[model samples]
Target: MSATEDPAAETADDFPAAPPLPWRLDGSARLGVFTLAQPMEAPSTVTAVAARRLLVFANSYRGGDVSYDALGVATLARHRHRVAVVPRHLWVDDPSIRRAGREQASTPSDPGSFAWSDSSARIASGQASVELSWHVRTRLALPMPMTFTYFVWDDGRLGCIPIPGRATGSPITMRINHWPDHFPELAAYESSLALRLNFAMTVRPQRLIDSK
Candidate 1:
């Protein structure tokens, strides 16, 4: 029998089905406006191995949510800089309900807050690269996949540019995913407001300090 048909050869336990969504959107999601604060930078000499270990440790200790910590480690490892972008203010169009509590509770504690689980490393063109993925929990405990790729050059310089992903789309989509089931329009507007506020919106790598 073919591998597909062979029961012993088939590994049913290896491949599990995905979970279903917990809730569905009743109406257009609300959007909250938020201003991206200045990029916080720190110095480090972290490697891919170190970054992975740091993420593992942070996630274990920090409520199983180490997205931001991973981002910090990745940033530092690749760019020698640890950075964070804080939201200054947030607002919603509908004043009827106060979403501040929910917003704050949902906001990522760090810039790279999505806990990436799977990682693959490779070397190409004289540079070392690592790709990472995370199963994001959205509206319904459903797993929304997210990914990031980092590269390190021969001279030890790390690339810190933010690559486009499912959550890093245009302002509208970005807000939609961030504030699902809420005022997404307001969130889009807030993104624009952040730009107007001269928020250091770009993700920049900071220099790492020598531990020694």
Candidate 2:
């Protein structure tokens, strides 16, 4: 009944929740930018079983409706990371998730692309600790936009990239969410621009880990 309450707004008495639990790096790949243009790479493939779920994929270009990230999943089954709420548009009918045409299935001809965005994920808690928040909105500017955020730690590794400052056709409203109970009261926010960014998140020491 909490986790920011939105498992499709839960109904029918609500009872269905599972995803998260895969540590030591089972899935993770990220990239983000603020004002130099060219840094939107993404991947956090899957970590379902209860380490508080996680799944991400990005390739969006909000300004003209050009999306190519056919794979974006999020689930934080437990272990804190609470305070959820970020749903504007995120659908494909679940069906155990397997719709290749945009992005998620690494190869097999790679053809995944869908435009328009607005996404959410939330969970918050305290007394010891727990937090999770995610946001993505799109219209590309002139009315809407999109970006991502992830913050899950207590040892699972994550929390650093926070870029917000742009100018390439300004008109922004970015808010990348983070977990640990939606810390500092909904982290990251901006309306205009002020420009000041420098980012890095490295963990490629030797990657090739995937558990199908």
Question: How does each model score on lDDT?
Answer: 0.22, 0.25
Using TM-score as the measure, which candidate wins? 2
Residues 1-212 of candidate 2: C-alpha lDDT, one tens digit per residue: 12322334333334322122111111111212212112222223323232222332232322221212222333232113422211111233222221221112211111222333333222212231221222333334232122222322212232222222222222223333442332223213321222111222211111122232
Please, what are the lDDT tens digits per residue for candidate 1 over residues 71-142?
112122333443322222122111111121122122111111222332211111112122222222232322
TM-score of 2: 0.19
Query: 134 in model 2: Cα distance from truth in Å?
Result: 9.6
Which 10-residue window in model 2 sums to the lowest lDDT?
20-29
- Candidate 2 error regions (>4 Å): 1-49, 56-58, 61-68, 74-113, 117-212
| Whole-structure CA lDDT of model 2 | 0.25
Best by lDDT: 2
Number of clashes found in candidate 2: 36
TM-score of 1: 0.17
